[model samples]
Target: MRTPPPRVLTVAGSDSGGGAGIQADLKTMLALGTHGMSVVTAVTAQNSLGVQGAWPLPAEAVRAQFRSVVDDIGVDAVKTGMLASAELVETVAALLDEVTAPVVVDPVGISKHGDALLAASARDAVRTKLLPAATVATPNLDEVAWLTGVQVASETGLRRAADAILSYGPRWALIKGGHLEGDAVDLLTDGSEEHWLRAPRHDNRHTHGTGCTLASAIAAGLAKGCSVPEAVRAAKTYVTGAIAAGFALGAGIGPVDHGWASPCRQPKVSPSGV
Candidate 1:
């Protein structure tokens, strides 16, 4: 019999566009060589344009789905995104607390088009409950500003942002500086050790599911037994390649190509190293 791949469970909302949310999480997991599972917390009528409608599932339904997977399947890592309401955030946090696996919280607050994915009231719940259960909390600059009052104007502000996020109790905080001007920079810290991840900002405007993809990629790395920094480094490399290969999808913004790691998509080099 063949050995099974590492298991990763994503607890998030469903994106009708198949770009962000649960869709992106599973895609990232599979691309990173993990067995991905999901527990849908909400269903959104969304596309590249924007979210048309969103309906959060009941807390019981969310709990049931989590139990069904975790009790039997037993995830090696978990990634969370788009907890729409305060109740849902707390419920998921409680369930995550019971799981022994490492958890990666995306802390998704808004969509690619500036639409809110998380309820404003749930911010506190995320800080107080969800964050404590996270091994890593990945938040973009906008999310950092939303969760913490610090507005990241430059790379200097990233440390403050990471510190603020670390105060919430996650083992590590990854403050993404993609929204800033110039190269994309991200700061990962655990209130002690720090890693600054920088990548050349590809001028791709179709990076719709970057946050979800990165977080899920990190979870997949952790599930495969990588250290935190090693996992983050691998995830950054994967997401950077995905962003570079992003292509146009629907009428509006598109999604990063999750299949960028496939052999056919690999960049070809000349024998003369041209």
Candidate 2:
């Protein structure tokens, strides 16, 4: 029999746009040669324009889904995004503590178009509860500032930002500097070692889902047994290609092409029945 692929689980919200959140996470996992599973925490009425509405699931529902996946199929790695509320953040954090796998926490506070995805009350919960359970915390420049209060105007401030995030208790912090004015840069550090990842800025404005894609890609790499630095480097290269190949979707910004690795691979159809 063929060996099964590494399994990565994403506990996140649903993005109807198929760009960010659970959709992006699963696509990133698949593109990186991993099997993806999901435990959705919220449902959003969204498109390329922005999120029109969002409804978070009850904590019980979230817990049930997580148990259903991890208890049976099992996960080699976990990635989380868009917890929506303080309750959900704390709930997910508690569940993460029970998981032996590496966890990637993408502290999603805002949408690509500046729309708010996280609640104001949940910020403290994420900083205190969610981040502490993370193997790697990936935050964009805006998220970094929101979580750390350290505004990153240039690359020089990335270290300070990473330091602030690390102080919150994640084993490593990856501060994404894509919002900066030059080449896209990110800093990954575990308080002792640092990896500065730099990529040529693609002139594409449709780079939606970049953060989610990067985090899930890193989780997929970890599931495949890569070290933290190796997983992050591979994820950076993959997301860079996806950004370069991004295309227009609607009246607003489009999504990064998660299938950039196998651009010509055809979709598969499952067999009729077991």
Candidate 3:
């Protein structure tokens, strides 16, 4: 018999555009040589233009799906994104209590097109319940601004945001500063040692799915036995290459290429030399 690949599960929304949310999380897991599974929390009618409609899965339904997967196939790591409501967030948080694997939480607040995906009421549940269960919390600039009052203007400000988010109880925090100008720098800290990750900002506008991809990649690494810092470092390298290989597909913003494993698979050599 053949050995099975590492198992990574995503609890998130579905994007019809296949760029972000559960779609991107599964793609990233597969690209990184993991067995990807999903417990979809919402179904979104979205394209490159933006989210047109969204319907969250009922709390019972979400719990049932989670129980079904985790009870049998078993998960090595879990990644969460786009829990649309407070009820759903709490439901997932409760279900996760039974899981013994590491978790990566991507507190998805909005879309690349500026459409709100998470409700305001869900923020508190995420902070109080979901975050404490996370091995790492990955938040973008806007998400950091939403979860914590801190507005990150530069790399220096990321530390402040990380500090605020760390108080929420995640073992580690990764503050993505892609929204800032110049180099795309991110800060990862365990409330002690801080690792500053800096990569040249690609001029690509097709960077949809970046947040989900990075978080899921980290979860996959953790599932395969990488340390928190090691997992984050590998994930950063993966996403930087993905962003560089991003290609235009839909009418609006396209998605980062998650399958950029080897140099031969990349579309073009980005300025960052990914």
Q: lDDT of each structure? A: 0.92, 0.91, 0.91
Error of 1 at 195 (Å): 0.5
Per-residue alpha-carbon lDDT of model 3 for 1-274, expressed as tens digits?
9999999999999999999999999899998989999999999999988999999999988988998899999999999998999999999999889999999999998999999898998889999999999989999988988988889888789899999999999999999998898888899999899898889888889999999999999999999999999999999989998999898987999999988875568558653575
Return the clash pairs for model 1, or none: none
**TM-scores, each model vs. reference:** 0.96, 0.95, 0.97
For every candidate in turn, the CA RMSD to the true structure comes to 2.4, 5.9, 1.3
lDDT of 3 at 196: 89
TM-score rank order: 3, 1, 2
Write down the lDDT that model 1 would get: 0.92
Order the numbered candidates by lDDT, best leading.
1, 3, 2
> Ten residues in a row with the worst lDDT in model 3?
263-272
lDDT of 2 at 87: 96
Q: Which residue pairs collide in model 2, if any?
A: none
lDDT of 2 by residue, 81-115 (tens): 99999999999999999989999999999999888
In terms of lDDT, which candidate is stronger, 1 or 2? 1
Candidate 1: which stretches are off by over 4 Å? 267-274
